[model samples]
Target: MTFACGKRLFALIMSPFYFFQSRRRRLKRQKWRKRLRRALFPFLLSLPPTVWGNVNDFALIEGVRIQPPAAAVLSPGTSQPNHPSPIHPLPPLELTAGRVLLQRYGCTTCHQFGKSTPAPTPGPALDAIAHKVSPTWLAAWLEDPFTYLPASRMPRVVLTPTERREIAAFLLGLSPGWRLPSRPDLPPDPYRGSDLFDALRCQQCHRVGGEGGLRGPALDRLGTKTSRRWLYAFLKAPHIAQPGTPSHSFHLVDQDALDLCEFLVRRAPSGAELPDDFTFSEQDTILAHRGLRIAIERGCFQCHAVRSLRGPSLPMPAAASTADSWLDHHRATGETILQFHFLPTARLAMHRALQDTTSIPNPVALPSDFWKLPIPPQGSTPEAYSPENRDLAPEACASCHVRQWEEWRNSRHARSLSPGLLGQLVDEENPGFIQHCLTCHAPLSEQYRTVTDGDFTPDHGITCAGCHVRAHRYFGPAKPDRRLTASRFTGGQHGDAVRTPAFRQSEFCAPCHQSDLAGLAFDGKLLQNTHGEWAASPHSAREETCQSCHMPDGQHFMTGIHDQVTVSRALDLEIDWKLSPETRHLRATVRIHNRGAGHHVPTYVTPAIFVKVALGDERGGVIDGTLQTRIVQRRIQLFENRELFDTRIPAGGAWLFEFASQLPAHAQLLTVVVEVDPDHFYRSFFEQYPSDSVQSASLIQQAHAQILDSPYILFVRTITLE
Candidate 1:
């Protein structure tokens, strides 16, 4: 070049050429990367779970040591049984790196917003998780990602145990579902609690407005008693709120529960000032110690965790050996035993453990007959009958009241007394005989000191005081505006008396009617299936409860199948007939339906009803010796797993019977009858196990008389067959 000047100019030109070569190289590299992605994208998108032999198993390749199956080498995001999986899973090496690059470079955002076309569902969308899973389950799953539903697609995230619980609580809030009633919108309304409490029978355990039972803490002041948030949580999940408390899934509707919360909150006294009568036990050492002793004797500490009372700790049941891990795992020891009993396999494990040691605590209370209620120590009445409600004689109320007294006396609620029931009270030979007979029958026998053993407060039968008095307080279903004060004669007793609608609800009778005993269920059918029947009945859907029918027009007669009038009013029977001359046969078809009753026709194991048909001659001589009997009852054979045939006509269901007989020339009469024997079987049951003393023989005679005289023959028809 000139040479230096020409060389400089050429150099400048060459610099641009070099820059262009470098740019071309970069473009070529990017194109190759894109081509690689196009090839790998489809394969990775398939989420192929390539199963292969252990990666550690080496293979000899031609002149090269082929590494452990490279595909099996998990990516950073891949899940391992021992380790938590990452936020989102991806394949290993180039595939994962390429996808991350594509995401980082904003290549896949065109269609799916971020990541890939088929994007992951955002965590917020899982608000519907409440409809899908239980709150406890969700919490447990989130606590340790693998704990519940290990196959769940939810990736392991950084959250503490408390955070998981809080998230679960929020998620568990009821949301609108396909079915509206099940997932009702809960608008806060405190007023609804007053009626809802009674309707739901919350007072059966919980005392509210000083008119309910003392089984649960008094709820006269919900606002000052506990925080609103805690109350809501407790109502939603009672067991979770206070662990080891005897809580149940009431299956309350969301709207109803919120309404109840509203009422209970408003129940609090104004300005948080306790009532003038409110007494403090902390100042009185004797009262405080008495309460402590009572709690211990009642076994309150068995389930509840009490932090106070630093007395010597009770010894815990020693743990069983885990040599049989399966047995140990499934035994369902301690608190979970009640739940375990419902599960078939767990029951077997628990039963085996029970042979050695009782692992399951029997917490059942309802139908207390199953628990073999303990008899009070010999010749001891807890108190000489209290004067006002002495013996709770049902007639005693007349001494005080003018209106309800006479109504109650005339009602079946008053006429339920009998001598045979009194005999069983003292009879100690068979504890089962002293079951819930007097609890509902003569519910106040303890107050009257009227029974023998008095184990189960076995009085002759029910009286007024039982339902009215609790903790020396009188309660009843008085109207909202009604004012109640101390009983005049029984001073200090029932002072500032309270009334609640729960007194008239079905829950009042649930003690004797609804059996919580697991033993009572045979093949998932209750022996005494009345409550179950009503629960499944359409009447429940219509809001027709037990009290609605039993106490119609404010009458407490409780007239059922035993009452002919009640029976006659409940059924609409129809009969169709056909006579065949060639076959010389007479056939009558009868259809019986539970058109009116809220439950089965006869809703107890004790009653055995029969629909019978017979053929007779006009001269009263048997023409065709045919007697067809259809038993309509559900009975469980005691101490046996087997059950007697249940032929009960379910509510709103029908029972059809066809009677066929050869019509003889002399056969001029056909008779069809539906016979009911209510107390016959029950009397016979008691007669089999009579008491030792004077009461036994009299009770036996009563039993015999019941079978003979108590037979109710309904719909007796005599027709002359042509």
Candidate 2:
């Protein structure tokens, strides 16, 4: 702990770098020359004992190998009342006495059975203690350890049997699962952690599992050595002046902290090797320090911070000093530094240097964005659409938006030509329909051959890469390069190569949804008009694009209660419900409070949402028939000559519907189910007749009818409907 010792320690830390460099420089003078034997021996001996174990497997890691339990100093059974004596008792048993003694002496500092790890190598691991020592010896050791073991390191204590027993029972009952009594809850989505990682660009220096730059530790599994709370605190605020310095205090937000902790804990080695607090040799420490310096010298900290700057600005370098002031300010205060940045070349150089220093990885030049494998430009007129020329899609997007892809897998856009509503129109019944569908549905480049017969590829329908990647430009379906449109086509590649830019913007989704295909016709007119509807709305006039409303806050999954709230606010009707009691039966009423739905609650479509009441007991035993009633029951006609069964109440008009059902006399609860059908549709007039020529009329009708019969339910409240 002296300044000299600190400097020596720091020197030891820097030795690994110097050792390798010294050896290399000496090698240039003499072929395969070894170091001066004595000098090299001390340097080698200077290594941390743990590193020696790492290299030779001979040196033992201190405090790791199990030692004999603290010698049996106290008589058995007297430690606590409930802890029966393993041997004859010499004193009275009590738990409170042990508790008092422990609290009075601050024994909890190093021996936390729960969430804290006070100091490394402070004492023995006490995760499960009944298996480690006898209750009698534990009590005696707590009271006066020097009594039995002359060289006992533990201090003597004075406490009654009650106080001693209390502490003893607490310690003896310790289990690995012990944690603080109160712990905060975590959010469902750990997306914040992923965002933090990207914001910090941790991969720039730390190589995790052979990937990423190796300027820092290969934290393939870090959770094994650290706690989640510690990591979370460290990510945001690094311990600059503390003993650990900048290594262990990178503070993280709650979610990111938890998620990263989960990720690391999952990476812990399968089998335990060394004890948690085992000390390392001086050599290992030196190597680590040298490695850290190398990382810094190569500017690995530019993008990846072992200690990130969370405040305002990037960390500034140490200021130049005058000639006479080298030792003037030994205690000079360092300015708070924010962050660092590295150029592509510098990053690559550091990567190479670290690999050479560690003998871990051979540097290989990779594309700037490794997620999307780069392709070279080829000489061609119309951009060739070969698999080789196309850019591989970036996987980084998936890292942030995994749940969105899962939902899109079965969407209409994903399966535009696979026997769904759109695909039915492209079957052999109409051979030319495939070409027409592909214009908007598949959105492929013109270089690909046109469809002449029934055909499909994994890339046939709207896929992630197809929509996101395009030639020359990104976002929206721009016209293909004109060079390929010539009559005598030269199948050469052009500058227009598939590039991913749409993933960053809303305009990317507009081309297919907004414009009409060249050939398709619906009843001698245009077909689907989602884009048209969106554009014509007031939102479009106000510069609100399709994604703004549908995908609130740029989330991958573009559907939620917010959309319902937005649309519901625009319309006048607000559907609210409650239950009424009547004898043993209960009446559930749905009251529509019209606020602002431009049309009606169930307008332009037929949706069946009703109030259903059911009586059940604690064991979920049904006792009565379910009573069901619908607001727009049995398709009643209203205004505008529309199939008014699904009527639109005036902007401010209200409607009330009710259902009554008997409850079990012994029932404590009755369930009232109220739902909203987001995907409801009225049978079009054409669909009501057999003459309608829409290709999937029957299938569409079947899907529509099933939905009408059983719509998606919404809120379910179990009031004392009994």
Candidate 3:
């Protein structure tokens, strides 16, 4: 054979391998694109996309049609996989791949999925979801996405009970025949179930043997507490149990769900055999009925009927009354029955209902935190209560520790009750979190834990009474310290002062400063790790503590990052500025050393230290292009469940920021400023709260005051070149 003929034969043999290689590369690229979109969502949050024309075509968004940027090129038809979830229904084989690809891409804000329109929400297309899953399952999934799956991509959307039921009713009405699933008839075995749960690593989120995380609730009594029908259906597909959970769905065998459901049912705790006897007063009965009437008129009847309206929502217009009414109904999963912050119009109507003399509630008021003792979020934490005047409350301590008390009175520690702080709540409704704040601030206010809106937080803060008082005794730094005082109200009381290990160590601040946010993990690291940082710092080896620098002489003013003086004292800054006129280059080498701080300079996520080097005029006006900024923060981008970046100076360490900028030949003034935005992160979220909200508005003003009062400005330097 000729040489050309032999070459042709070789080409033919390798053609098949080349075809498969190209296909694999395309799939790999597609997978990376999906992961990148999710990871950088937060960066794009503030930069929502503008209209763009599709590649030589147009797409529909909502009702208006938009032409994507001409440069945009969409995937060529359904040849692309939609990050295929193994169990989700497959697209119709008859439909062209192009048609399916359009449906796959929903939002072009970052990643465009569909060719024509925007999705109403995240997750699978649900317009015909009724045909795929039962309406009951749909409702359950929408209510609590987590109960069903641990790694679901759905974002939790807060909805009223009525809205959830309305949407569910609408969906269930669509298709009736395709609901529910086919599972095993085998009876549930808790023993086998327990083994499966362990194998599946369910303990990562839930606690069973008292060794799991706090992200999910304890499930030892889950079976006894819930309906078996819901459990079976939920196990099959978590979406049927809860809709917007962050948990991931699994491709489990049908029998897996059946066995798990049965085990859960069998493991449930026994119920109280009988309902406890109770009676209602004429006043209480009338109040409940009035509240029920209001809710019904407000369209709450769709989901709750005449029963419980106790949900984990904002307060109603007359939240004190409506929130306490109705106890007979079962709240659906993921349904917020207690969140009562009604809309403005609803508040107006509720007010009118109350004003009417003839209007009185007919529903029974449920037992709630409004009139019940609170369960401490971290179990029982009892503090000392002193009836005698010997107690060193801030006011009483002012007598002997006059200077320290006065300093604390004007410090950030004295002003902990701001709307920004009050608004720091769990994304999921957690009653325990409500009391968590008071655990450190008020420490002993029962009203703080019980009353949501009506009670006033005592202005004690981390007061003199915080550390010294425990039950009926007082704690101090030394031995043989005791005091007794005669009480005007109840004869006399006794208080013995004993040394406490916490007084001399970091543990004193641990209860409040330490936090484990499993949900706020960034690359498998907790976002809030102040206590941990301190424990690992060089300061720990020498037995130095948070109190060492902040309380040099037992000063009550906890000189924190919020105080400019305190901040200046914590770190040292040295800047080297230069002007290379020949090359038109302006250079700076800023060294920030953690001089006194025991941990990261700022210590927390809230404060951000900003270092800016730029060309400026004699009047302090900045020239463009010569500016470079470095931010030192904890990178608590919890919204994305990931950290973008973090650069902070650790104890006995230094951060060197090198900046070189091309300068205009005539530019002679150079300025280097290092300041701190104490409430940088706080302000980011605080802006989301409306000023018209009485509570938030007050807090907004107070936070402004705190930011103003916080420590800032390491130094300002201006260097002039001839």
In order, candidate lDDTs are: 0.47, 0.36, 0.48
Number of backbone-clashing residue pairs for each candidate, in the order shown: 9, 47, 69
Instruction: Give lDDT for model 3.
Output: 0.48
The C-alpha TM-scores of every prediction are 0.42, 0.34, 0.43
Q: What value does the lDDT take at residue 152 in candidate 3?
A: 44
**Can you write out model 2's per-residue Cα lDDT over 543-613, one digit (the tens) per residue?**
65555545545444444222345444443322333434545655555555544332234432334445555
**On a 0 to 100 scale, what is the lDDT of residue 287 in model 3?**
38
Off by over 4 Å in 2: 1-412, 421-429, 436-440, 445-455, 458-460, 476-545, 559-588, 591-626, 631-644, 647-671, 675-712
Pairwise lDDT winner, candidates 1 and 2: 1
lDDT of 1 at 380: 26
Residue 220, model 2: Cα distance from true site in angstroms: 12
What is the C-alpha lDDT profile of model 1 across 1-722, one tens digit per residue?
00111112222222322223244465564454345434432332233322211111222222233333333322111233112312122112222222222222222221222111223212233323344444434544555544333333343444654444444443344242322223245577766677878788888878765577877877775554444554665677665554445665486557766787778877867654322222333334444343333333222222222222222221212134431332344246443221111234323332232222111111111221211112221232122122442334455454334345545665556655554545434433322223234344554435324454343332225455556554333445655333322211101122223445555555445444654322134566644546667778898788777878777755656677668778766666677778897988888998888877878977877677788878887785555468788877776654344576778778898889988877877777777788888764566455454234565557656655655666687777777777
